[model samples]
Target: MLYQSFREYAQGAAKIGIGLGVISILARWVTGITIFASPEALVKYGIFGGIGYALMGAIALMAFGWLGKRVRKEFGDGLTIGDFFQFKLHRVGYWMMIAILLITSIEGLFTQGMAAGVLVNILFGIPISIGMLCFFLFCVVYVGFGGIVLIQRLAFVQVICMFAAAILIPLYFFIAKGVENVYQGIRLYHPYLLVLNNHEGLFFMCTGLFIGFGQVFVDQATWQRLYMLEGKKIVPTFLLSGLIWATVPLAFSSLIMVVIFTGSFNNIYSLLFDLIRKIDTIFLLVLFVLCSFGAVTSAFGAGLHSMISLIAGNVYPLLKPDANERQKMRMGYMLAIAIGVLSIVLTFFFTPTLLELLFFFGIIYAALIVPLLFIVFSKGKVDNFIPLCALIGLVAGYTSRYKLGNLDAVWVSMMVSSLLVIVHWGSKFIKKQLGNH
Candidate 1:
């Protein structure tokens, strides 16, 4: 079921039709971070902030639909984002992109692994180490052994669990406690949540748009799915997936309101635990656990699979052009297992708050967005300076963070990259005009 042949194993079966395409994207994007991050936004920046969080993701995914169309029109036969970079970039630029993508993808896995540890610890009272090990092992087995087909099948089931929880959990809370009580409770205890005109919230929304655009635009997993889908289905699948995916963060944010209405908690996980206590039904509890676990695992699996694809498709081939299909498949499996182990180790040692982690990496996403966009839209191969632009932006962004703060650093990063690209293109345009004269 996983592989039709070695070729299929290397580059999926290309059998993810429209319906499966939507669900698979949904499963990948509707992540554990969304479950917690939406509520955290609401609590920190008010209602608008929460709405902004959902809007950023929805808009990003929808925007990718347009990019997907371009991708198919330009290079429909590509297997991975690495393939696109290989074609669009010089050797140095391609390697830079590959390295950046690998770092970010590893970070993605680490985040999901952390979320998995938290979920298992919360739900089953298991130690985080044991929980993380189990989660990593599960992903390694299925994704490493079964490839894209297995991941796609599991994605469908995971998405079903997510939708069930997103719809039912919030609805049940509203019915049981009543919206009026929830609203009144927020008014009495956390009135900031009700405020509509939060300037900070607006700032966050704008900056978040930059971060979101950068993230989805460069995500190898999203690009992999684009290749997996039928050519005609690409835009509609992403557009519909974005629309459906928005509801998840919206619903989960509302659920957070229900928890805070009762009382404030020490932290996000505590709030989650309190919400679990409020749900009197055992079935709902089980559903919530399944939903949370599924989200984490699905996301981790997607990241792992994409990383494997990038290595096998781009890195390994360059290293050993003589390697056969079976050899490539074996390398992918080994990489998956190695990544799983590394992710577990990292998750155990590092424990930053979710938003902190996001903002820290926000610098990279901000820096990458402009160059990646220029690469995609440019008619011909881009110069080596494009990747160098990203590198400089990253340096400037991080340097500015201590003085200006995280959000400002993101703006600086984006501005620096955009400025560099614009100047280079303009200079070239002027040179061409002078030559014509």
Candidate 2:
């Protein structure tokens, strides 16, 4: 169906049921980056990487159920995350977050585009630039024009394919290869993977929890999804989605182990390509490609659509005071194309490993988690310092990178921001005591 109003374009008038609601949330979170990055994590941190990565996201989703409950209680209606942000934030904080949201949204799309570029290059012998361009354009057409109705409809199908691949491929690999053969191969080549006491892996799980919380809290797609569900279903839907979503990463991680123990691979992408090339089963190979493609497009589409909805609903009216719903919807379509172009361009020039990309974004996610928690849970108008805490902590985190490793820098950002939040609350209490005197 053709989308006329911006709300219809964004969320299909918030009429989604618990079943599709779960699928939509799954599509948003089980993204291209998650699929590729989980395997990469397994390669680096061994068994801990696979399970820890999956567990981190599962916990984040479950935790968001709590935040979602409180947020709906306070202000139950909204089109985008920006609607909630505008209601809670003063002018300065509102604009600061809007700017950050735009940046992070673009970063999200670029990362997905990178995954698509790599996949197409491996499978079809397409140039990375051209493949990414096609990916962006396809998303723009589907998400920009088809709107949330189409997104949800496609999400239902895409989700089934992804789960099928994650389950069937791993089950097939393990059964055919035999558990003993794979286990011996790993023990022979990478025995460290079996170590029960992996210090770095433990650290990754701990620090990764912070990143996961912040990411889910601040994510535009997730917040938009909050307003899309029934009031009673909010907590349970989010919690269940997290539990089921956890399986994809762990399964994908095991799927990669099918071949990686055979020989040394230079990087995750090469290892992924090798896995694909080694799979002699034709139907399984087809399923893998579809899974990869579905993951990338669904993720990119979600990010692209959320941003367009945010701008059309929250930002455009400020620029065009007299604009109507259709006009804003039109602007949303334009924004989708523009953002898609920008994402493809950036992905073309700025390429990083999936692990590197995650750590880099971790600073932003970590610093914002507490401040956003403040925005939702606190009473009265939130202080301007709430948003400033994120900005300041982000700078401190990235700046400290010279002296610290990537994960440590991310923790530094979270701590600094949390400290600022504490000071803000402490000062408020002190002023109340002074007034009593």
Candidate 3:
């Protein structure tokens, strides 16, 4: 009896742990763009740039735990972060925050849609519009009908497939070609990639970190995970996921490097196509397919799920004000389908190169980072004008990019907003003191 009970307990614990781990990987780490974007950075900027890309994502995931703990403490049993914000913030402030959230979330889905279109083009040689529709259909069915429980279940399979590919594919290549050959090949074909301290490269790296922190902290999918996991499980899950997630990008980036070590390509997409052509081994092709699909689906699923939470908790509630859980869930499902379809349509026409796309949005993400950190970490309510400061800084930063360049634009924007908010608050404090006197 004792032995049986112990076995049963262990099995149950394993079930929950595995479920949470899958969710961590799928909900936070995996994304359609992550697969395409990280390797693209590697090729454009160098291997170090790829490493920077991966580190940005991992760092963001680890830091989110701090936000998670505070959120749960402030609003226990909440299904979404918006729920907490809606309750804590007054009407004007709540709407302001919600508007920002919706814009960011939509941007995220738009990116995901682009990745899905690209993946479909690669996998099936189909029109991007049709492929995008298929992507939308899958997300709608899984997230809408399956709910959180099914989403979590699918995540486990996705995580397992991702790890297997990240591990085995790299291992096979290193073993077959030998590490020295790959290294020498990289040196011969792309010598600049080895130079880590290049001035332009280092500058981008620092700015990338700031943009990374903002994107991770403000992302709704990540916030949803914060409440779903056991409180103690939150930090460790993020830390472990970060460590494991680091390996995927490094491995995939290196895989691309191995392909290019022999010759040049037209662009990132060309490199991907070339890699596909060069790999005649059926097993390796299957592995690549699984890896690619896993990355895209994980990202799409997380984005869809979080989008639902925002609509259900933030937008719908404002209109209804007295919705029950079932009504909220129904609205959530409807919103997911509508947004998914819209993103798919938008993806059909997006033409920017991957790095350019990231840089374009990186300004907005970086501008919001400090303001959010202030909101979460500050002792009391922040300066009301701080949100507007971020908006102004974002516009200013991107507009000045031609004059200052991308890296400098980020630094300047962050500094300018910080100063403006501080000055704004100081004047308010001075007036309050004069009134008291």
Candidate 4:
């Protein structure tokens, strides 16, 4: 019955055709992070950095299809990445992989929690803690009870609202200020943003690309979407999603330009408030509200649901391998509520600016990219120590951040980890050759 329900959801989605699917995909991928973080990037880095941040995510998502195809082909029927890793890897390796996944999941909560807090503070003048609680509660209930069916149903609505906002918000601003005037304002007030090729900016883009690849490639939420679609639609769904997803960040970044061009703001939330006040049209304000809500909720819902699937399918089953389907479902629902509560609690205590949080998470993700790619693409079992090398890389890169500086950390981390992986494997290869002789 559960399988039948899943089949109906997947196929029934086709009745709306690819357009709706594209919108749903857009909503799922283009979350509050893009809405809040891109502008935050604009405030801190420059206009180019803002656009780079957006581009990185879109590109990451576009390339994830390759990873998805590989994963599905290897372990076609598995429900989660953790499940696939458990079957393919040794106990030590599997635990190591799950540890990384769990860390990423925690970071995912942190990221979304920050974005939710910022949005709530922006839209309604609500306290971040109160707003976060409401956001988490909504996500937990919708995802836990409705499962993927309702998540996707609301994702379609979310995406439509997001795209409408993306197009209309910028269009309204561009019309008001005129493109030439907006450009002049950016150039005059925030000239640093206008310059694209600063050395720090260039390195940021390169590292961002690597980090982007890892994020989309390894993310469980994205992986869940892979199997949820028809095999034929799988590639196109991701591809079109990427294309449509690109416009959103660009639009949001440009909207921030409208904000920054007008005057300086102290923080991202303040910039959002400024934008809200500056807009003349009531329709646009409502659109902003819908877009903000949709972006936050789609991401929150996907995270909540995907995390539930991970815990139930991957973690719970380990202790109770013989558990029935209903038992698994019950565990999943409970876990969904637990994660939501944890996210709300976490939001209250820790608050970092959205871009800082993104880069902080980016370092860990960047470290994992080399090892994960090696594992996925290599023939047969790649060396287990590769992931361990990544852990070392994250430490080394971060240690260097204060000593060497921010831009340099990404490079140091990537190079150190990649080189260590080679050295670690080389020693093992040489030892094995001697033994064979």
Q: How displaced is residue 198 in candidate 3, in Å?
A: 1.5
Output the better candidate (2/4) by lDDT: 2
For candidate 2, write residues 38-87 as lDDT tens digits: 99988898888788899889999988988998998889878788998889
lDDT string for model 1 (234-278, tens) is 888989988998889899999988888976679987887787888
Rate residue 147 of model 3 by lDDT. 52
TM-score of each: 0.96, 0.97, 0.88, 0.90
Better of 1 and 3 by TM-score: 1
List runs of model 2 lying over 4 Å from the truth: none
Candidates 3 and 4, the one with greater lDDT: 4
Give the least accurate 10-residue stretch of model 3, judged by summed lDDT. Answer: 1-10
- Ranking according to TM-score, highest score first: 2, 1, 4, 3
lDDT tens string, model 4, 105-151?
76776678667877778766898878888777777667666776787
Which 10-residue window of candidate 2 scores lowest in summed lDDT?
Answer: 1-10
Report the backbone clash tally of model 4: 1
Task: Quote the positional error of residue 341 for candidate 2 in Å.
Answer: 2.0
- Candidate 4 displacement at residue 163 in angstroms: 1.2
lDDT of 4: 0.74
Candidate 4 least-lDDT 10 residues: 6-15
Model 4 clash pairs? 47-193
